[model samples]
Target chain A: MKQRFLNDTNLLLVFSAAILLMPIWLSPLGAAYPDLLQKFAIYGIFAIGFNILFGLTGYLSFGHAAFLGVGSYAAVWSFKLFTMNVVPAVFFGVIFAGLLAFLIGYISLRRSGIYFSILTLAFAQMSYNLAYSVLTPITNGETGLQLTINDPRWIDSMYITVEEGLPSTNLFGLKMSGYPGFYFCAILLIVCFFISLRIFRSPFGLMLRGIKSNQNRMNYTGLNTKPYMLSAFVISGMFAGLAGSLLAVTDPLAGAERMQWTASGEVVLMTILGGVGTLIGPMLGAGLIKYFENIFSSFNKNLLHEVFSFLPDGVEDVVVQVVSLFVGGGWHLTLGLLFMIVVIFLPGGIVEGFQKFGGVFGYGKNKNSDSSPQNQAAE
Target chain B: MDSILIQILNGLDKGAAYALIALGLTLVFGTLGIVNFAHGAIFMLGAFCAVTFRKLLTLSVKVKDESVTMFAAYKDEPYLKIWFGDTGEAIIDYAVPLSILIAIPFMVLVGYAMERGLIRHFYKRAHADQILVTFGLAIVVQELIKASFGANPIPQAAPDIVAGSANVGLWFGLGESLVYPWWRLIYLCFSGVMIFAVFSFLQFTTYGMVVRAGMRDRETVGLLGINIQRRFTIVFAIAAVVAGTAGVMYTPILPPDYHMGMDFLVLSFVVVVVGGMGSLGGAVTAGFLLGIVQSFASMNEVKSIIPGIDQIIIYLVAVVILLTLPRGLMGRAGVMDD
Candidate 1:
């Protein structure tokens, strides 16, 4: 018990340290900026929450982005109507998303496998289409929901007067932007991760895992699986809501595009790429994908030229031309190829790849320890 | 009533495209048991085949114009026109239909390559893995198309002879106000022909009989010493050709874009699910049904009543159907429910 406790603490300490020191360590990778850092933290939370439902219970909801979108819209509405303070915004985000998720989860959880995926997808698409068009009065349509200087923030108006420009979303006057915003997101991520880790080690998590493995057997054994599955779905949806609210808190804008099917696909890829069911894998996957998106997409022909300058001019030109096709506007191409390779060669994702490589060097004892998540969960 | 009639007519062409694509999707699901998210990419590739054929046929020579000596500008005089005059022009005019000749052979090769190289390897993998890999392939195919053709939609004109709208309303005594596009009617007929050909081929041939048996139970058929794998490859190829032809025919209606396949992918999957996962007839029926429902939902009367019913009617229908039926319209009891 003592050894296990130490290992658990060690893992938490290592993870916290890595995230807290991201700005310092990630400078070499040119991804230390506040916006990208915030995205990493936010998407990490999204992926972690997604992993809880998908990795833990094996229910893949393709419409999780709907919860995220609902959260953002709710947050922005809160900011517009109630206050610039993020607390109320977050509450609204979580509550609205939870409500939407409960409704979708109630209907969608009726079926499993691809049926579940399609139902969730349909609900999300309906939400997206509604948000994009008919719900324009609430969502602000294609222009998106934005805060304005002239608008009344009821709570803020009661407390204090505002200036000419729109007030930034804040946590009791601590501005939720730049490094401060990233740290706030990082702190929340750590808390969420801790919650996720505890869930993974809990009896409830084991029950969920059982549902994932063989729900029919569990049902035949007289266990009601629906409530457990619904709980998992709602919890994950709330996490998505939290992430969505955090996005609005940082940027103070909510757009319909945030709930697109492609956005849902992105989270799914992140979870799969990081290692499903494993605690830290999804976060790493989120960071890698975000890094590629922000950094790689910015790679222009000129940047490629500078990177390939070491080679002869003729070779450099050819190399840049070839490489340029997979960067800048073509970064998605690289992502697609990388994802295919991972699914084909590394189904268990980067974590499994690392374990395999470590195993090659005779790290058998370490491999046997805590690598089989099922064993740990079972215990 | 006239509007309703026109709407049905309008739905038929789009319905034809949906049915054709869904038919292809169901064939793979039934025979090979692959989800094949990249099936729509094959459709897009077919549209591009037409685009490429036109581009190839219309290869232009630079004719110097003495009118612009400041830069000595040259005008592109199509090589076909330069070589054969009216005959070349006529050939270029017919590029969209003529591309079918190339689309069939090319799509077959692509099918064979995909099955032999990538898909067969995934025969034993989980459904999730299959979905992910195929989705990845879909993305790659779209990206490659974007890289080559640029992201903009390429317009493929139907043969000029059939470019105008037909007097279908007059034929039906509905008046001169209800004209439909000749190209669309042609597309409807073309899809009908394609669907018939596929059905006849599958319904009659000994090869298709073996395929049917394999679909029912692959191991049992294999026990009988039939080369089911080879037959499955041919079926995949047939799917590719059907989707390709559907795309080729759709060019005049909806301009061919790199992401066109992706837009269809979701809808086709919905069609497949609603029809029944592995039911070919169910797929065809659901495709047309959903297409018609979508068209009807888009009417101003319906929009005013429900406000954006058109955007979600198909999904709403799918959800209702899946929830109520569990196995879809013609889905077997144990097919993919788990």
Candidate 2:
């Protein structure tokens, strides 16, 4: 018990130190900028929550983006009706997404395997199409939901008055944007990580692992699997919701595109790329994909030229042309190729690759203490 | 009543596309047990095949005009027209139909390559891995198309002879106004023939008999010393060809775009599930049923009552069917639902 507690403490300490000092580590990778950093933190939370349901229970959802979009819409609505404070907005975001997840989860969990995936996908696409057209009144159609200056923010109007246009979201008086916003997201991410860790060690999480491994044996042992699966689904949905709320809190806008199936595919890619079921793997995956999205996609021909200026004139032109294909408008091609390679060659993802490399080099843990939970989850 | 008739006509045209794609999907699923998310990408490639054929037929040569400034002011005379006079013009006019000749061979080769190179390796992997890999392939295919053709939708019109609306209302004693596109009717007829041909091929052919036996129990068929694996490969290629032809025929109705495959993929999957996984007949039936339901829901009266019914009717039907029937309308009891 003492050794286990020490291990947990060590893990938490290391994780906290890494996240808190992200500015130091991320700067070298050119992702320490505020917007990208916030994205990393937000998508990390989304992936972590997704991992709980997918990695643990092996229930692959193709509609989790619905909850994320719902959360944003709810948050934006809260900001419109109530105070500009993020607390109420985030609260409503989580609650609304939780309710939506409950409804979708109840109907969808009736089937498993590809059937479940299809059901979730249908629900998500239905939500997306509705949001695009029929629910235009609530979602603002394709224009998206945004805060207006003339609206009756009942509590904000009564308590505080600002003369310089629409007010930004705040915790107390500190603004939720730029460096401060990133730190706020980072702090929340740490809390989320700790909670996920606790769940990983808990009996409830063990039952989820059991369901993933062999639900038949679990059923034969007299365990009701539906409630457990539903709970995980709702919890994960709430995580997506919270991330959505954070996005609105930072930017104060919610678009219908946020709930698109492609967005859902992206999170799946992130979790798979980072190594599913491992506590830190999803966060790593989120950061890597976000880094690619923000940094790699922005590399224009001019930027490429500037970077490769040291090369000979002829070689530089040739290099730039080839490198340009993997970035900018061709970024999706690169991403698709990378994704295919990873799924085919590294099914367990980067974490598995690292472990194997370490083992081959005799740098692995001597006592097999590094027999990661991900390995068990992958089985 | 005329409006209702027109709506039903519209539904059948849309349903034809759905049925063709779903039938192809079910064939592969039944024989190979692979949930091919990339199947829609095959359809997209088919549509592009027609576009390519048109482009090739209309390849223009710049002729200098002495009235202006050399090549700066030139006349674009198509090489085909210059080479063969009216014959070249006629070929360009009939490019969409003629493209079927190109699509079949190209699609067959693609299907064979996919099965032999990538899909055959994934037969023993988990369903999640299969889905991911195939989805990845779908993305790569679409991205390549986007790189080559650009992101905009390329509109292709039917030949001038069949371009106008056919006044079906006159036949029904409802005046001359209730008309439908003639090409859509052609599409519906084409899909019907294709589905019938596929069904007949499977029912009468000895190769198809071995395939059915393999679908029933692969190990038992293998025990009898038949090369079931090779036949399954051929079936995959056949499925690809069917999807490709369906796409080629659909180009006149809906413009070809890089993302069209993804749009149809989700809807087609819903059709497959509602029809019952692995049941070809169920797929065809459900495709038409959902298509009609969608058309009906989009009517003003239905929209006023149900609001977003058109947007969700297919998925709603799928959910209801899956919940109530579990195995779908004609799905085998233990194929995918455990």
Candidate 3:
């Protein structure tokens, strides 16, 4: 028990140190990259929340983006109504997403496996269609909702501001854009991560794993698992909502495409790519995917050619063209190949690969000691 | 009244395509127990095959006119055209029908290879992994098609006999205004015949009985010394042929595009789910029902009340049906465990 406690403390310390050190490392490279870090942190939060339901309960939702989109639209509406303050916007978003999840999960969780996936997908597509048409006033249809300069700011009047139009509402007058937004999202992600850690360790979490492995056994044990699954769904929805709200804060826009089935599939990919059941795996997955999306896509043929100038002319051209295929317009193809490889070879995802590597180096034995509880209990 | 008839005719044609695709999905899912998300991509590839055939038929070399430029003044270049006289040209002209012959064998090989190569391994894996891998494969196939074919929708014209609208109203005592496209009528009939052939095959053949038995219990069938996996692979091939043929027939209605598969993938999955997981009859019935409902919802009357009801009506029906009857319309009880 003492050794286990020491191992747990070391793991926590390493995680905290990594989180703290990430920004320090990234900032030196490019401090003022517009909303890049914010995007990563927010999406990480979404994936983490998704992992709670999918990772624990073994319910694969192909429509979690519906909640995320709902939260975003709700936040945008909150900004339209009460105040430009981020608190009210985010709060409303989370609440609305949770409510929506409650209704959907109530119906959807009745079916498991592929049926559940299809049900979620159907509901999500319905949401998308509605947002595209009937709910156009809220979602702003295909054109999307944008924050104009003329938006009212009730919170700004309380603060001392010399500017006439609504001053950008901030946390204690600190601008909630750029670096501040990234920090704000990072802090929220940390809180979400800690909460997820607690949930994973909690008895409820154990029941969820039980439900995942053997629902029949749990039912025979006289424990009603529906409410537990529903609660996890709601909580995950709220987390997605939180992510959506953060997205709105950074960009102040909401599009119907945010809730499309493709977007839902993306979170699934992120979770699977990272390590479905692992806490930090989703974060790593989200970071890796988002980084590839934002950074790799920006590298054009000219940049490729410049980088390959040292090679022979024929070889240089072939290399540039081939490399560009994975980076630019062929990103989906690359993602597909990666997904296939990961599913076939690394079924446990990047986290499992890391564990294996650690084992090879003799550092994984202690790690597995603490981790085996969750894995064994799940199985 | 004439418009209504025309709309109904249109709806029937669309329903035919849906029925075929859904039927294929149901067969694979029922027999093999694989969700087969790449089925729609297979459909898209079928359409591309038709486009490719059409392109191949029209391939010609262009020769510069010597009289037009100083550079070409000295020589007249011979241009080669691979024309095999009038009959062969006529055969090439009827590319849509020819595509049926090409798509069957091509898609069968694709199905066989896919099952043998990738999906066979995923039988024991989690459904999530199966879905992800297949979904990824779909994306890869779609992107490859896009790279090869470009993004624009390619129009594949029907042959001369079925190129234009036919006034079938004269025979039915309706006004001449109640016309349907000739190709669409042929497609509907062809699909009906195909479905009939499939039904007859399954009803009569010993192989079909073996397939049904394997679907019921592979272990039991294997105990009896039957190679159930081979039958399942054949079923997969049949499913591919069904979807491919559906795509071939549908090309005249909608131009073929790389993204067509993604568009149909969701709706087809909805159809499969609404029909129930492993029921063939359920798939056909639900496909037609949803198709008709979708068509009616898109009408001006329905649109006045709900602007995009048509777009979401199928999903609405699916959710309601799923909630009220968790086993779907024809799903076996307890098959879909929470």
Candidate 4:
């Protein structure tokens, strides 16, 4: 009981500290920086949601982006029809994504392994093509949907007067254009994190673990596992939808590219790299990858030349050339190498690495021992 | 009618590529139970091989004509400059055809190395791990190719003898309407012969029987004292050769690009899945069928009704077939149900 209390207090303290530090760290980077952070946070949330379905259930979905794309489209439509209020748009996005997941997951979960992967992939590709062509009016085709100056800001106009012909969205009079958007996304992420935490600790989570370990045994015990799996699938889809809604809220744009299988694969990579099934790992993975993509891609040879200016002319040229190979335009090479090394050496991901560190520090050894039996029983 | 014929021809060519790649994927999966996501990268490498060969072939020794007399200058015969250069120069002109021969062994070796080095380690791991590791390897291979070849598509022209189209309509008395490129025809015939050879090798030979047995039950074959893993490695090499050959032949049609592998990867996997996981015949058949359907769907007439149907046709077919026949068209019974 005392240990449980300690855990709860530690969690609360961590939460409070994170909330306080976000603004402090973000402030120095200025307003535009938070937009990117918001994107990272949103994608992190999506990856975390995906990890729940994939990491726990062992279902490698190659179509999760379909839900995200659908959610974004739904949010954009909501913004178009209903008030420019973010809440209703987000809510509708989650519902629409969940509904779509329910339909697809029902058909897809029937098959397992590579077939399941192929099925999800096929579905996503179908969606992508459909959006690119058949659903062009809805998805806006390749040009993508963008908020125009003519969009009816029903609630925003009534709540506060903005200059005519200006493009903007407001959430209960709070502008979603900058810092407010980041805070909004961060709050959503914290909420999602806590909900995922609850679900992970719940009995349902234990049963899902059982289903993953041995589905036949679970069935033989007379437990109806389909509903449970479906529930998990829907919940995960909703989380992805939330992330999608946040993306649209920040950017007010939706593109069919969001539903591409590569985007889905990116989330999978993030989950695996950060440590699948670990709560904070996917978030860390998303942040790290996005940071590298945003920051590393911006660096050019001129910057490299400046950094290596102290070196001799010939040496500096060689150094700059070599550094450019690994840095500018060759970011994917570095990412691929990182992925290969991580998968080969640390298959359990960064979470496992952290756990090993904790073990070395003598903090997790006894904790793991006590948890092993419970884990085994749950499995 | 003319448009229909053209679409059919286009589809057949595209289907030829899909069939070749899907055949390789099915071969590896059937023999080794490994879903190789890197098959497309191998295909791309094959195209690069052709490109490299083209580059190597174009190397020449240029000499200046020094004769000043009107008749003598006009009749100047350019002699090959020799600094041990004639021998190297002669080899360059025949590089493209020679690359096909060279690519086979090179790709086979790559296949063998890849199997022995990375993939062999993951034989005991989960399918997810296998997919992840292979996918990672695919990305690495693709990026490496990009680093070497740059991002743009490199055109690889066929030999002058087979560069232009053959007028089949002349023989048919159709006013020279049915003109097909000679190189494309050669590719089709080559792919056909190669497919036949692969089928014949697997069907008629004792080694093929052993491979079939191993595919059926690896442990049973291992217990029978046959080294199944080594055979699997060979099968992987054979699959690589097939994909590389397809890539070599396809370079003229689609030009070689680093990202070409990624573009085909999803479609090829769709073909493999639709063909049934371990069924080789199914893969070939599905490849052609989807290829034809995709071709027909891309027609202007079809596009009027169903916009971008060509892009989604294969995937739609895959989804429908998977839903209807969960085991795929010719998947072994009780294999995919789980």
Q: Per-prediction DockQ scores?
A: 0.57, 0.53, 0.52, 0.44
Expressed as tens digits, the lDDT of each residue in A229-307 for candidate 2 is 9999999999999999999999999999999999999999998888777788789889988888888889899999999
Which should have the higher lDDT, number 3 or number 4? Answer: 3
Per TM-score, the best of the predicted structures is: 1
lDDT of 4 by residue, B1-338 (tens): 66677677778788889989999989998888787888999999898888887665554435444656453444322233244456655555455666888799889999999999988877666677777778888888988888888999988767667889988668667676788888777887887887888888899999999999998888999999999889989999999999998998888788889988888888998988888888999888888889899999998899989777877888888989988888788888754456
TM-score of every prediction relative to native = 0.97, 0.95, 0.92, 0.90
lDDT of 3 by residue, B127-164 (tens): 67777889989988988898789889998889887788
The C-alpha stretches of model 1 lying farther than 4 A from their native spots are A1-6, A364-379, B64-74
Locate the minimum summed-lDDT window of 10 residues in model 4 chain B: B75-84
Candidate 3 regions off by >4 Å?
A1-13, A26-34, A150-169, A366-379, B63-92, B333-338
By TM-score, rank the candidates, best first. Answer: 1, 2, 3, 4
- Of the pair 2 and 3, which is ahead by TM-score? 2
TM-score (chain A only) for the predictions, listed in order: 0.95, 0.94, 0.91, 0.90
Expressed as tens digits, the lDDT of each residue in A106-148 for candidate 3 is 8888877777777888888899889998887777899998766
Model 1 chain B: worst 10 consecutive residues (lDDT sum): B329-338
